[model samples]
Target: MSLGKGNFQFFGGSKTLYELKQNMATIGQQLQKTEGELSQKAIDPTASMEDIQAAQKSRDDLKMRFDLIKEQHDQMEAEQKAKFAAKDNIQNIADPNEQVMKAKAELIKATIRQQPIPADVKQILGDRNNTGGEKLLPTTMSDQLLMEPLVKNPLRDISTFTNLMNLEVPKIAFQLDDDDFIADTETAKEMEVTGDVVKFGRNKFKVFAPVSETVLRGTNVNLVQSVERALESGLAAKEKKVAFTKSPKSDEEHMSFYQTGSTAIKVVEGANIYEAIVNALADLHEDYRENARIVMNYADYTKVVSFLNNGNSTYFAAPPETVWGKTVKFIDAATDPIVGDFSYSHFNYDLDVLFERDKNVRTGIEDFVLTAYVDHQIKLKSAFRIAKVIDTP
Candidate 1:
């Protein structure tokens, strides 16, 4: 018997391709064995009639099984071709409106190819023209196909600067201590004892995605994709901006490394940036100085490019990849030429990202709501290790 209603609709029928292939393989092996035996009997000059007859009978039985299996396999393939042809025919409609209707129906039926549009959403589809349903359908072809792809966040992979740790609870606890291990001397008193220098604290932050029912159900696929894009982009840009431009206003967040007084490398008026960057490397410790990278906004990066173009060619060899033997990252939040080992920074979160769907929670919302959120914070291990070359304003 077949499985569920439309489990194998895409495969043409409910019969699994695995089972069909296995059956064919078993039949093929039996046929090969029988053929091998028949060949052996014919090659032997002293073979008796009984042996030859038995070999012939085995070959006949195997041939029947092989033929039956081959026929079934061919039939399944034909059915698949027919099913696909029918699907294509449905898609090949001449009229644009008819094509859209067919596509919507296929989208509704083909759950694997489509994100789940809940029952509440389906109900709203008919009533999309009602009040508060202005953006009822997706505007683009590609957006109608699937969910939006995630925005790429380069900081997520950094090991030194950002710790991308998963948290099960609301806060991440850690111990801060400036005390170092003492070298005991025979003449030293009490092994250089000191007071308790350890401090305990937790990092906490709340990220919220307040999605409306109109966005979830009333709008089309393109709007849904846009909403997803906005959520991810906003999270990435805001967190990085807060880390690089704004200091932590409360205990719930970590302080920005840019705010560290000792981390700044002031540039003289009309001073060459290339020389300024070289000097800024000294601000970071020698251990991390080798891995130091330059961060600037696209505008600043372009200005540097123009400066290099007007000067010596070998001075700024690569255009976008490297500048003065160091890798350059163009971040929107970066206002100055910041040099640091960003890998030392950390971003903590829950494996279950803050985004979730809630149908009954929203009293005013009439449709299903999908809220994408993030619970995360950026931590600076050693603020002094990051140096920013600021222009005199």
Candidate 2:
């Protein structure tokens, strides 16, 4: 969540976390709305004092229930931050081997977090109640620039917190041996094709069936006490509690994704993170990618860089944050040598910079991004945690 400084300063590391907080605001609003509705019902005009008090008691109980759940969500968020911080801290060791260790740790955490998506969950997620939990981009561009995706599935956001609900996200089962060891049901069921093809001289038609059971692969299951050991597994083990204070981006101005602006960084879906990062660096280095069609500020993108660090491959930019005249992306490799660098992502700028920048806090070029241009954002993710029950299963 913290950018230590320098190159890390320009990296999306910090901006991403801020946007996450932005997404959290919506959840908070929902909570407050629920509170207001409850209060209205409790203080109904014709209610007796006894009835009002009873309703008030019910409200209090509801508040506690939300608070309890909120606490858990807060804990999960804190743990996520801690895990990120730890990975970054380790990466800062300045040792290539240590850096690998940390990246490996991060990768493991990502994999472990993914472990919760049990096959059966595909069924649970399809439930009607659960469908509301997902959001989609506006039917149209929703605004001037094409800054939205066709889907609003929160789980796909690369910068958002790992979804903890319904993914079968692992939880503590209990501790044993006086906390010397811990237990969890963090197991996964993966289907694989293993039967022999039995192609005998191109003769005979044969049928094959996949086994329903799983072969035990190591789970991230670990004892709850060791931080270093936990990192060795594919899941984040760091746990903590966090209190989120409301955060709003600055009134820096605005630009839509693919609109004329000085700071907008158009992004397409399926863009590779690594590739986007390099391109952003290169774009800044080369100054601007091209002259803007509506606004003429793209000329300022003229800052040219000699090369990407560690190689002669100077990062390049594709004009208007575009490539081959298309706005959507399917891969990092598709970017022009110079065009793939800009990113308005979690690691970069966020939505409030466009919608509510008048109040949100910002750092780096994002100050320019909100004030200068509209970005073409093709990916969307929310920053909150909640569960949607289906059929009371």
RMSD of each: 21.3, 34.1
The lDDT for every candidate, in the order shown, is: 0.48, 0.28
Residues forming the 10-long window of minimal summed lDDT in candidate 1: 182-191
Error of 2 at 31 (Å): 5.7
Q: What tens digits encode model 1's per-residue C-alpha lDDT throughout 263-367?
A: 332332226555556666665555456776776677766666778778656534566656657777767776556665665454443222222233335564322
Candidate 2 ranges beyond 4 A from true positions: 1-34, 41-44, 90-393
Give the per-residue lDDT digits (tens) of candidate 2, residues 115-210. 322222222222222443322111111121122323221211322222111222112223345532322111111001211111111111111111
Worst 10 residues of 2 by lDDT: 236-245
Q: Clash number for model 1?
A: 14
Q: Could you tally the backbone clashes for each prediction?
A: 14, 41
- Top candidate by lDDT: 1
